[model samples]
Target: MIKVMDRLLLFVYSLAVGAASVFAIVMAAGGFDADWLKNAVDDIIGEDALVQTLVIAIGVVLLLLSLRIFIVSFKRSGGQAPSINQRTEHGDIRISVDTVENLALKAASRTRGVKDLKARVRAADSGLQIMIRAFVDGDTPIPALSEEMQKTVSELVQETTGIPVSEVSVYIANVTQAPTTYKSRVE
Candidate 1:
């Protein structure tokens, strides 16, 4: 849907540019004395200085729309906030929940047997609860691996973000295997 909308917008922009280019050519070639060119252009644009004012307004609106989209996309994905108990006024240092999650994910990825880490947080009355989904080796023992992952993620989050982790839940989403290719000999 988004791709279709983008293509449609691009097509409209291209058509507008083509029309403007043609108008510029006509304006230049005919100078100001061409009555037919003047009437044709005016009929299309109308009498309210449409060419200059409308074009400028549309350009400004499009520019602002694109900038807003860019800023939203660049913002962090997770929407979790720290627990009320998690607030820290440790002198001028300011930290956001999104920053903490980013650092914890980075740390979790450093562990052996872990393929990737995606962390999420939930605010609780006691403290903040963390959930870290890790893709790891399937051959490893689930119990031991889960324990290690939980411990590591909790320690990393606490050390890095200064947030107390009441729970560190690990979910193993998938275990990847090496790809195999088939070879055939031509007779």
Candidate 2:
């Protein structure tokens, strides 16, 4: 729904810009003899093609800046990578919530002592939020396990997806399976 709205807005905005640019070009062409227009613009700005080029350049720069901000804001503190925002404008491309969640899950699974990982992501007012569940071995220390898991998973996801992980819930579902003894194996 949000994505649709953004597209609609962007389309409308582009249409408006195009209309305005055409009007400006026509006016400039007609008023080439006007002293004010001539003084305000040079050959670069006076030419219709040049005006169009400048508009495009400005649009590209603004789009890139918006993307940069989105990436920076979506990331967790501590120098983590930016989180991709659902409404983030990146060179006309948008990142979905599902993609961010999937990346988080994959990153969590890569951490040591992490057996299984499940991540859920939802859109927030300003950005996106995440919930993480990690299944770890029973022998792993609670404090150390939580800390390391948080760091590894958070870093990986943030770096990969550029979305800040708002909340990470670590649930140690069960301990790792014990190795089979020789006698047990024989039996």
Candidate 3:
């Protein structure tokens, strides 16, 4: 999944940055006096021209790899809120995707069996599609609840925004028991 890949890339970038920061800090704190590092530096400085060239190439490759990873990790357009454009007689009307999502959430919340609802709205060929993920009560009937949520969301979106809903897909992610309060024995 793209989300998983993005997270993985971000983790790698973080690690690279952390390592570089620690290395720089140690060098600034006079870690260059360490015998191993001193010897390694001396060897590098004393190497033949061909060997120095190869070392420089290897360093360049690593730098380029880190830079590529850093850029990819930070450049993400998916996190930005999207908008839907509609043409009208007077002008163009643009509606925020968040508005559609909020509309769908409100409609779904009105359904009796739905809880912990989240909605994502996207532009579709016909109009818009509403994808909802929700938690339902354990006793709730899935088919009936899904149908109710679909109808409610479709109708509400159309009525409120005049946006035709191509489809309302309800994914029941979880079923949870009602919350109960417990009394402490000491109290």
Candidate 4:
């Protein structure tokens, strides 16, 4: 949810900056007189207490927005890689999440009945949970296939990356049809 809000802020900031840039460019191109803008702002400020208050409020809001964007720019304190970190006596190791997902897919695809496979991995409370969505051959029973796939994926990912896999959820999405081979007879 926080990430979503940050993205929203970024989008709004981008639009705001673009609009300001265009406005400045137009002003520079003599689309409007600088004196006209100064007079308009001066008139608004001199008009009434309410107008002056509104101008101050708008300035404050924009200032706060800019400050927030500046801070969010540095939210990630360091250049952090997208990976899982492991600490050992020698040093530290980082494994890419993509690597783990690929490992899961590789393991699941090796199962006899699976024709096509894709995998997703997410962090769980104790370990990682892998979800495999597969298209399978119609010959095998889904229950046995799913069981085997789950075991295979979990074992392979853990063994390879040393990342504990808590569960592997297999979704047998569809049964794939085999391609037919054409045969010709000579006359």
What TM-score do all the candidates reach, one by one? Answer: 0.47, 0.44, 0.56, 0.69
| lDDT (Cα atoms) of all candidates against the true structure | 0.71, 0.66, 0.86, 0.86
Candidate 3, residue 21: lDDT: 96
Candidate 2, residue 108: how far the Cα is off, in Å: 1.3
Clash list (residue pairs), candidate 4: none
Model 2: ten consecutive residues of lowest lDDT: 79-88
Candidate 2, 126: how far from true, in Å? 4.9
User: Residue 149 error for model 1, in Å?
Assistant: 1.1
For 104-143, candidate 3 gives per-residue lDDT tens digits of 9999999997769999998988989899999999687899
Instruction: Please estimate how well model 4 matches the true structure, expressed as its whole-model Cα lDDT.
Output: 0.86
Candidate 2 lDDT over residue span 72-184, tens digit each: 55766574344443445554434665677777777667666777777777656644566777767667676787777667766776677665655665666666676676754
How do the residues 30-146 of candidate 1 rate in per-residue lDDT, one tens digit apiece?
755678876866765786676768767988866765665566568775655543344346644445667767766876777677887788877566656778888887777877888
Error of 3 at 69 (Å): 16
Q: Which structure is stronger by lDDT: 2 or 3? A: 3
Q: Please give the TM-score that candidate 3 achieves against the real structure.
A: 0.56
Q: Any runs in candidate 2 off by more than 4 Å, and if so which?
A: 1-90, 184-187
Candidates arranged by TM-score, highest first: 4, 3, 1, 2
Best by TM-score: 4
